[model samples]
Target: MKIGDTYFSADVETDGPIPGPYSMLSFALVYAGQYDGQTFEKPSKYDQIFYREIKPISENYEVEALNINQLDRERLQREGASPKDAMNDAWDWVMSLAGETKPVLAAYPVSFDWTWLYWYFIAFSDKGSPFGYSRCFDIKTAVSIKANLPFSSAGRSKLPDWLQPEREHTHFAVDDAIEQAEIFAKIAEWKA
Candidate 1:
């Protein structure tokens, strides 16, 4: 149930799917609740996780979602959060609320976010991961199977125009985490 003090949900942005070549741009965690056997609650979650956008490190490139974040490299280089500092801070924050035991890290695409974030941070921080947990759950995959959501190529375009800001939507890693949190609140049980 209680790990140390809190439960955490992780949000991650990656260069692309798969590991190694694809780097973790940034990540965030919401310590809303902790794993009690197998239950989660909305204790309190942050609206923002805020992390710098980094260049996508990839070997096999697919233009499929190249500009998903749509951030300028120059700007990112100037304002990027070093992988070491970012993960250390996030993990510390997650663990601070959790007990010594590892907490569940719920994410949209648990596999992609968890592995990418775990590997990237372990290597970058070189401190190894203090968040000792074995299982990572994928909300997206789970939701897709359960909700039967149809695939659609249209993303923002499918969204209302009023929702679209003139400037590119904040591509910072944390911003994405916030969005996912909101969606989860509405769907409750996860949907693709």
Candidate 2:
């Protein structure tokens, strides 16, 4: 097995743009693959994953954002994992998977997803972020660099057919994580 940073494709559905005021309703991370300096090893499938739903910290939330993911706030309040517990579980899972290699957070457009996750990890876990700070890869940036296109033109619709994932981009975190993992893997192969 190649040893280096393992690319974990992460997706998050939030109650709003930020974390403290809003909340991360749910999130997922799929083992996309890894690349040594010489070559890439793609996961057989993006099935190795972790997911968790969190209880909302604040009642304040955007109704439109809540509707997007269809997460029941009341149900989450009653049954969802506490934010600290959820973040601890995620940190433990990621560390277990990483054993030897470092785990790097990968996302389509990393800004939004990374912001929420990093905030949650720090706010909830005394152990600190499993990813630390700045260990993230943006797939959109990868595509932009690989295709030699302007960053603004790196949207999904602008992706080359070879780099597109077959799965749909449903708002559900796990589903989208898997979908984004496929894209990440393809990008790695091409870039290799």
Candidate 3:
């Protein structure tokens, strides 16, 4: 039996602007909730999460980008999980959570986070991307269209106070993912 789409709110902290040249320092996926076409069942607690910090794939990294997330590259280099292990574990986690439901990735912007995640999943995991190639929901775009605001005005800072998540926007991937999940839930239930 096919169930509703299971949304996973994702966040990635990277050492550079894009994947390939830079490395994804860490990433997190929070089981946002499930939508059964008629209603979105928002989870009471954003506790089910998959998080991983992986070793850099390349030596190239920007100091400024690294400073944003404050992930110690040297420490990660020594202790972080290998990309293959992390990605595979991520795939398993997503599948386990989703079960019969179609897994859908949700993110604030989606583009940046999806890009890194897709690249890493494809390059490392044998099972490949759990969300496939394009099953993603962009909270920014949803706010823009749903709220009848210009795309430029849909940034988190510019969004209506009601739509804002109570959680702080810490640079940590898991924290950010939970925050984004809350925002997505609000947007999904919003009438406008």
- Give TM per candidate: 0.64, 0.96, 0.98
The model with the greater lDDT, 1 or 3, is 3
Which scores greater on TM-score, model 1 or model 3? 3
The backbone clash count of each candidate, in order, is 11, 0, 0
Candidate 3 local lDDT, residue 138: 96
| lDDT at residue 24 of model 1 (Cα atoms) | 58
Candidate 3 clash pair list: none
Question: In model 1, which runs have C-alpha deviations exceeding 4 angstroms?
Answer: 1-6, 48-66, 141-172, 182-192
Model 1 residue 11 distance off true place after TM-score fit, in angstroms: 2.9
Over the stretch 1-192, how does candidate 2's per-residue lDDT look in tens digits? 657887889999988878888889999999888777778899887789899988999988999998889999899999999999999989998988887888899998999999999998999986778898989999999998888999999998788788778988889999999989998888888844
* Model 2, runs deviating above 4 Å: 1-3
67 in model 3: Cα distance from truth in Å? 0.9
lDDT of 1 by residue, 5-100 (tens): 243456665556765766555566654344444454554546424344554454444454348755444454567677667766766665565546
Provide the overall lDDT of each model, using Cα atoms, as 2-decimal numbers: 0.53, 0.89, 0.95
Q: How close is candidate 1 to the true structure, as a TM-score?
A: 0.64
Of the candidates numbered 1 and 2, which has the greater lDDT value? Answer: 2
Worst 10 residues of 3 by lDDT: 1-10
lDDT of 3 by residue, 18-44 (tens): 899999999999999999898899999
Q: What is the clash tally of candidate 2?
A: 0
